[model samples]
Target: MSLECVHMPISPKNLLVVSHRYRSFQKDPIDLVSPYFDNVYVLVRFNKFADVSKYVHIPALQPFISSSKIDYTNKPLNLEVYKTSMFNLPLDSQYKKLGKLHLSVVEKIIGENNLNFDLIHSHFIWSAGYVGAKLKEKYNVPFIVTAHGYDVYDLPFKDDEWRSKIEYVLNSADAIITVSNSNRECIKKLDVKTPVTVIPNGYRQDLFYPSDTFKCRKSLDLPIDKKIILSVGNLEELKGHKYLIEAMDYLLRIRKDTICFIIGEGKLESRLNKQIKLAGLEKNVKLVGGKPHNEIPLWMNACDVFVLPSLKESFGVVQVEAMACGKPVVATRNGGSEEIIVSKDYGLICDPARPKELAENISLSLDKSWDSKKIDSYVSQFSLSVICNRILDIYDSVLSN
Candidate 1:
């Protein structure tokens, strides 16, 4: 599916982006779109606990906590980032109040730096979207929010109060952007009047293109003879790492020539490790903590197939990255994976959380002959250039209105 390139004329204006994690998928669009604007100001919300983590000695908690400081030495010249700390408690009732707290933190930063912007785009509806909504009221600027995963599908349906809060944020926005049709339907459940656009997450073309499989495997010190099955996601319950391990148990019964590498770190690390030991998959399935963002492309190239066993997803950007590397994907029928792996050409999809079904699909994918060039060609539509053009068109429309 080729995307039509919409080339809008660039105007001199500043853009303020409010994102919880500015370095992840949120950063992809900004990297491409920032050149068109005068300056792109990013406000990254950091947990106040990270400051305390610096003094405390907790190895288990360190993976979840990030440094409050952002090094901009290698960042884009037009991009300006502000890492601000906020008090966030992991309680269901405290969700709405966190919005006001976020607004207060943002207000302090804006006042101290005298930052100015013509528009605001926030990732995730809660807290960030709330801040955007409140700021839109204050400055009368156009505000757009991207509802990704939990913020769209889970939070709004939590309770009556959460439903009302989410509705307020959606209706308050000039426009809403979601990652998938499934998420768009979730927004429709609220029945907000605001226009919602679906812009699928994209991968960096320069970083994720095809490479030499032999060289990649050699560099990563992975076995060249084994059929590699790689899955990269945080080791959380919703990510379905446990199901993948279970599938491996079934997979090895038929074929022992495969190795599964799960790359990530989370609170569930110890529990998953214990599961691997009990299942006797310590040799077949290896939990290779987490790799750097840039190093992930090498892993993708080294693997024979990429698996995304997520139980729920808004859009699996990792699947697109793997496809860009000309590698086939075997993902679950999670909302986003089905849309990405639309046909049998790119990859196969199995029922979520089913170990036997997942194992069958993995074995089939490993034995099948896949055309790498076709898979690579199919993923071009979700490249950074195409996705950013669509987003910029939205920006132009909102500003012109």
Candidate 2:
């Protein structure tokens, strides 16, 4: 395929993005990248609530762009393709199947829409990267990939075939990016030739800043006097909630007044509840399901400490939010957390699967004193504007090449 370069007077080379599960416009990189581009379009596979177009805020932004949805509910394709199944199957199985589906979908989009995208920016390497590579083969357009953790860590274990698919995307994408340097190293271990960049997940700090702790606690019906510990992630085994519950067992042994809140729903919710009961921590720990993203900073401010004990992570965004709210954090050494947490300065790092260590770290984060201003200052490195500008530079370098 002969790739044609298109120069735009007002915007970036027309870009097409593919994200199977774009939470909302607030949670999208495409939205951040849109300002740096001429026209941007995102194609999402399946939106269960028919909410992708409604909740995602791309339509509001001008500059000649559109958001389109594709129906895959009844399609012969596997539903789990391009979706996270919470560390159940080997990571590679999900990636391989997802790669195949991605190729098929991209072909359909190009043919049906008569599209002319100068560059393809895929959100994840599993489905989007694979599809982007295939599109590059057909359209000859350069494509860039974003690796959001699990796609690199969980997939290659015990499955060589699936690992190859990841390698293909990593090596082929014009520029590769992950949420952290830890993840960049993981990709390097795969011997990928493409340039890989470490871009920590960025957020709109203006919207996600800290609020008055007293008012937030009162609004949430949480006790004002007791110290609160917050954790936000899908309730799954890899999230290591079991370890968090076990940590609570230790916290209560010393400070009986502490309360731990685990937010976000998942299949392991029932099992996590059972573990909580077994630990005799009914009063100390509570499992609260997922809440809107906008309401998270309030939860952060209301808590004294934020704990993220994931067995694996690309980058833990919740930890950033906590730090941004001037709250201390206790996270695991795995993946991105090791790079994000500023050691004993901002948060403590312990083994996520080890209950005793997790407990000790959580207690330390809550009881100890770290300069809140320092923690907040460290978090400013990951501000949306900083990361977005870096991303734009990467895009510019790719286009110039």
Candidate 3:
């Protein structure tokens, strides 16, 4: 198909994009949208030692210039500034002025770039959206914001300051986009005036799919004899890894051959380890540090079931990935899970924060003979091409207006 034939009418002017996760470039919607723009200016914070992964290293598409460099080194100077720039920090630091320093630096970067942006696109409400609201004020540019999880669900709304700041961004932005219907409802409760659009995060179908299970397992040096149950997410309390571990322990008790592998890492790793040790699952549960995002499909395909037990999520992008790999999902009935995991068909949705329920549902999933076709059908809804087209349509509607 010709490029012109497929693309909706969109003029590439200037799009200043900001996101927290460009490090995982493949999952970034802005990366998918870059082809439609004349210039895509991205602003992202990257850990000092983390390599510039797939998304940032892609050979530039000329005439569609894009560049960004966020200093997130572990040095004391950068660390001090980062601490002050943090948004929606815990109650102890809620009154702190971290967001102020963060915004100042962000504003300076916007100014220094001399970017004559027609609009600002911020990912999430607290950090990027908050910064975008300021850019809208200073430059009189039409700004749009996208809300993803923690920005809305994790923030303490009872606090007047956090509530006021988030509401300010929501009300001030020219447009708002969320990844799921659930997120839209959550935003409306915050009294956001900006019209909210539901645009899901997408996967690179070309990169992720149901692959040779044995080959994937062999490549990872995992035992071919075990029935793998996999969970992918940062090791965090909210992610509900503890619940999955509990479920896995129960499964192992019943079927001693089952193994659970967790991918991704965070501060919660230690706590999770303790849980696994306490449960006597140290031999069966493996906490593998984060693999490159592109390599996730191999792990997904190698597993019999994919679990995302997040107590809360604006949208669980990992669930979609599991479906894409033709594996059934068992997730919690938290934020976005309801919007995506319909019911007994696509995957199981257990009560949020309940380990026993999670174990029961997981057992059911393991017993059932899942239809691979159904799995593919479920994930296809959020394919990158479909999501990119939806976002392009949104941009088209905005620019056309």
**Number of the top candidate by lDDT?**
1
CA lDDT for candidate 2:
0.72
> What TM-score do all the candidates reach, one by one?
0.95, 0.83, 0.85
Candidate 3 per-residue lDDT, tens place, 1-401, comes to 11111465466567777655443432245656666776777665332222322344222211111222232221122111111122332343643353454567677776765666777778877667777888889888778888877677646365777788788888988778888787777777786677988887777687667788899999989998887899998777788888888878767667777888999766677788888898888889999866766689999999989999998887888888888889989988887887888757888987887878888888788899998777887788788878878877777776666
lDDT at position 40, candidate 1? 89
Q: Relative to the true structure, how large is the alpha-carbon lDDT of every model?
A: 0.88, 0.72, 0.72
Who wins the TM-score comparison?
A: 1
Better of 2 and 3 by TM-score: 3
What's the C-alpha lDDT at position 127 in model 3?
67
Candidate 3, which segments miss by more than 4 Å at Cα? Answer: 1-5, 25-27, 46-96
Candidate 2: misplaced stretches above 4 Å? 1-12, 24-26, 47-95
- Candidate 2 residues 116-212, lDDT tens each? 6788888877777788888888788888988887788766543777678788888889999888887877777796898878888876676556678
Sort the predicted structures by TM-score, highest score first: 1, 3, 2
Worst 10 residues of 3 by lDDT: 75-84
